[model samples]
Target: MTHWPDRPICAFDLETTDRDPRIARIVTASVVVLDGDTVASRTWLLDPGIEIPEETSAIHGVTTERARAEGLEYTAGYAQIREALCEAWVRDHIVVAFNASYDLTVIDAEGRRLGLPGLATGLVFDPYVVDREMDRGREGGRTLQAVCAAYGVTLTAAHQAEADALAAGQLARALCTRFPQLADLDIMTDQAAWHAERQRNFAEYLSGLGRDASDVDPQWPIRGIA
Candidate 1:
């Protein structure tokens, strides 16, 4: 499997220590590689340097002692994940996520924590933003489950990293099926252009509702938006 598919993609998700990407550490992460239609995957549980908060633990269920005994030591696990994601990115394969900014930011922050470089540079696809753009003028939406329902994709396990990523990737496929607007995207789509276009569409949609979604994503110094 040295060569990739015409639609080389990977659906991935990460569980972290907190909500803030700058400080949150990765507790676990998974990558489901997609070669055209077939899939292969690998996942990792890591010993995040900090104690996992009960609130987050309640969500993903990795406890302190359990992780220390069972999970890979933080540095090695982090390095492996970083290497895997970077390898995929280098191959021009797109990494798909639901709310991509949150996950990707956490990854970057985690890299700094582990003394490793960022895994993904710019090529990524986000189903959440795509759904919002497609369902403009609709009310009571913007969640992964909601979007999946809107597109007639069934919801499986929610918040489980691997499940969510797989669902998001499927949702992306459905969107391309119905909309055909996002068919050309890949994991290496430059964040600057990607985020800018998404910001524009989202802002207009929100303004139509007299609300502001401008601050939805933190402004980062993206390398290649134009």
Candidate 2:
């Protein structure tokens, strides 16, 4: 059987208007297809139909004025993004992301809000989760930038959707290469259980520290769905 890294990869990323995926609006999105030496990518900038908060704009460098002027309408742009991701899934590509729960949740919530079909989640790979699992206690920071550095992957543009997506694909490949046993795991079932356990542990840690762990969801890939 071909391992995940040897297969085509469709990595995704999003820069949004808020940290809460339930309420966040996509300001920019990217889908990067990496198949062997060939790479293809699509990116979208959406107007989000709401004010791009100053702090969020500062992070993504997408001002509300620029987005309104140059970005596609949110619903339209998001529809195209969903279509691209669905096509990737249809092609049997492994869907990859850095912190997948956030991005995928944003996509899922956006699809629901826009009345579009939901995303397929069976073959998803999150390098963040994988890294946490593989290298249990060795982390300083697990942010994409830090993980990229740890894996010797160059991330030239940190916040740009296209750059982040591409780097995530590279990071996923690097991880699979280093941890060859990862190929033996089932993406859907094993990853779901692993993520749930990881979240539960985190919640317990928070509770021990007197922090509310209620917001720490145990769902993987997507959350808050009924």
Candidate 3:
């Protein structure tokens, strides 16, 4: 059997309406399933049950009209996305998202709202979280682009969901190699625990930012490139 480090994994990314996974609809999603170090990829464009705002279209370039015309229906798209997430989990692949909390929570909430079950993917790797844990004493905290810069990983085609997924995967792999200790930590975190840790980190983080704040925690954890 392959080692955990070499195990099957899913590197995923989503482009959404907003940063809050609860309110944001997944406009597009991509999953790259990796066996060992080799990967096979899948991507979907979705009609998110709401009009795509002009600003969002400017970011990801998928207009509401275009999505409605060519993209899969919201229900069908969610079903397909859920199937991929569940399958990836059952196969023992880590559901890798650069910041997993927002995506997983969004998925869980969306499935429930749609009368479907939660993602069978029991675990997730937030490269951002993992990077923060590993590089706690380091400067320039763990944004995907910044982490990629620190690790010398190049990000191509910024704002494109599929490209962002691949780039995050590259950073995830590099981080694992650079800090093997993290792979040994318990990555099977529940939403509440993940949420708690993020809140704690942000509060501490904002103290560093010199911002006057009652609390630095935003209700949402997925910062950018949702």
Candidate 4:
């Protein structure tokens, strides 16, 4: 059987105005397509239509002033980002993200906010969920940076959309290389099941600690629309 990373793949990442996907506005986004030895990528910087909070700017290095001057208008940039991903899907590329739920949800919410067509759910490979399933007993964080390090992949610019997107593609390839069994499973179905199970386990762990676990959603790739 052909392994996933051995085939064409598209990796995506986003930097946004807030942590909550339901309310967040996209500030930057990237899509990286890898096929054999060729790589193609597109990146977008958007005005987001609101002042980016200082803390969020600190994380992504896109200040309000900079975004206003250099970024594309939100609608134009967002449309392009959506089109890129859709094109990759049409070409049968495996779409990858580090934590797909958040990025995909950001796209979903933004599409609704702008009255644009939503990105249909497609074959998605999330390294965050895969790493948890593959190495459930490993210690330490599963941040993209940490996972990249663990897999000997270099993430040169941690929060930059293009860098993160490219690194996610590399990390997915590395993961599949390490665990060939992953290629035998159906990405959409198996990943969804794994993510749901993991979310349930984490929710139980939180409940045992007497914390509110009500917000723990098991939805994979995208969360419920708000």
Which window of 10 residues has the lowest lDDT sum in candidate 1? 217-226
List the candidate 3 regions with Cα displacement exceeding 4 Å.
Answer: 189-195, 201-226
lDDT of each: 0.72, 0.89, 0.74, 0.90
Which of the two candidates, 2 or 4, achieves a greater lDDT against the reference?
A: 4
Off by over 4 Å in 2: 1-3
Give lDDT for model 3: 0.74
| Number of the top lDDT candidate | 4
**Cα lDDT of model 1 overall?**
0.72
Model 3 Cα lDDT, one tens digit per residue, 55-154: 8899989998888888899989978988898888778777778877677767776877787765445567667777776677888856777888898888
Clashing pairs in 1: 94-187, 123-187, 123-188, 123-189, 124-187, 192-225, 193-225
TM-score of each: 0.79, 0.95, 0.83, 0.95
Instruction: Give candidate 2's error at residue 136 in angstroms.
Output: 1.3
lDDT (Cα, tens digit) per residue for candidate 2, span 94-158: 99998889999999988888886676665899999899888887858988999999999999899
Kindly list the per-residue Cα lDDT of model 4 for residues 19-73, writing each as its tens digit.
9887999999999998888999988999988999999999999999999999999
197: Cα error in model 4, Å: 1.1
